[model samples]
Target: MIFDYLIYVFLGIGLFFNVLAGVGLLRFPDVYTRLHAGTKCTTFGSIFLIGSVILIGLKLWWEKDTNGSVLALHSALALVAILLTNPVGAHAIARAAHRSGVKPVRAIADHLAESPPLQTGEKTDKKQQPQEEGGK
Candidate 1:
């Protein structure tokens, strides 16, 4: 009975975070903020949801059920995958978005632009180039 209640609580928390992520994605003004909300919220939500499954699996395994062991193992593996991939994927997307010229809203300082690494054959916009003293 207690285990069931715990499972319900975990599920509820997970659902709440997931819903919050959706809301953030929809309500945020810029891509960076949206990505922040979406990625962090979803990752946190998935943790709770998967945790509930792990608990269920443990309970079953304690009862000497083989399926319970399998379920627990698989759930753990899934959690690991999510933990490893979510932030990295979000980072990649954010970097790509920045590289493609999407600027954050109301940003005061752009660190990436200030110290960009050298890349051979990179084209600079005409406006970025220095004009000759005599207007060559």
Candidate 2:
């Protein structure tokens, strides 16, 4: 009785957040903001979605269904993967955007402006070139 209600609650929350994420991706001004919205909302939504499955699996396992254990285990594993990777992937995308000179729209503070790019090739700037040895 209450279990079904709980599942409904989880599903509702998950669907809400996932839909919110879609809106954020479309509505956010810059790559950083969009990535933040997309990653955080989707990650949180996936947790609720997978959590509902875990609950279902536990309910089935209580009824002596072997497949329920597998379902719960697989859902748990997927949850862990999503938790570990989503933020990291978002950060990577944001960094790539920043490195490629994408500026945030209407941003008041630019904290990363002082930080150097994480990876670079040989510098072509004349000032960056070293002086010749022995004035050669």
Candidate 3:
């Protein structure tokens, strides 16, 4: 009885965070915030979702179901993958966006603004801008 209730609680919490992630993606003002919300919320949500699954598998295994071991193992592996990949992927996306000159909407403080630019082979001519696509 208590175990089942624990699963239900985990399910509810997971669902809430996942829904919040979707809302954040749709409603956030800028790329950084959107990515932050999506990655963080989903990671947290997935932890609980998979945790409940693992609990279910353990419950079944306790009842002598062989498949429960497989289920539990797979869920644990997936949870590990999600934990490892989500943040790294989000960071890559944000870094690419920043490098491509995507500025935050109405940002007050930019920490990256002070960081030294990446070193390229050719010197960056600050005074010279890239030619416009339709330049005569």
Q: What is the C-alpha lDDT of each candidate?
A: 0.88, 0.85, 0.87
Number of colliding residue pairs in each model: 0, 0, 0
**TM-score to true structure, per model:** 0.83, 0.82, 0.83
lDDT of 3 by residue, 92-130 (tens): 999888867788999777667422422332136533323
Report the C-alpha lDDT of model 1 over 14-125, residue by residue, as the tens digit: 9999999999999999999999999999999999999999999999999999899899999999999999999999999998898787889898877776234333223564
Compared with the true structure, the alpha-carbon lDDT of candidate 3 equals 0.87
Q: Compute the lDDT of residue 68 as modeled in candidate 2.
A: 100
Minimum summed lDDT over a 10-residue window in model 2 is located at 114-123
- Stronger candidate by lDDT (1 vs 3): 1
lDDT of residue 48 for candidate 1: 99
TM-score of 2: 0.82
RMSD of each: 7.9, 7.0, 7.3
The regions of model 3 sitting more than 4 angstroms off are 108-111, 117-136
Report lDDT (Cα) of residue 121, candidate 3.
23
2 versus 3: better lDDT goes to: 3
What is the lDDT ranking, best to worst? 1, 3, 2
How much lDDT does candidate 1 score? Answer: 0.88
Candidate maximizing lDDT: 1
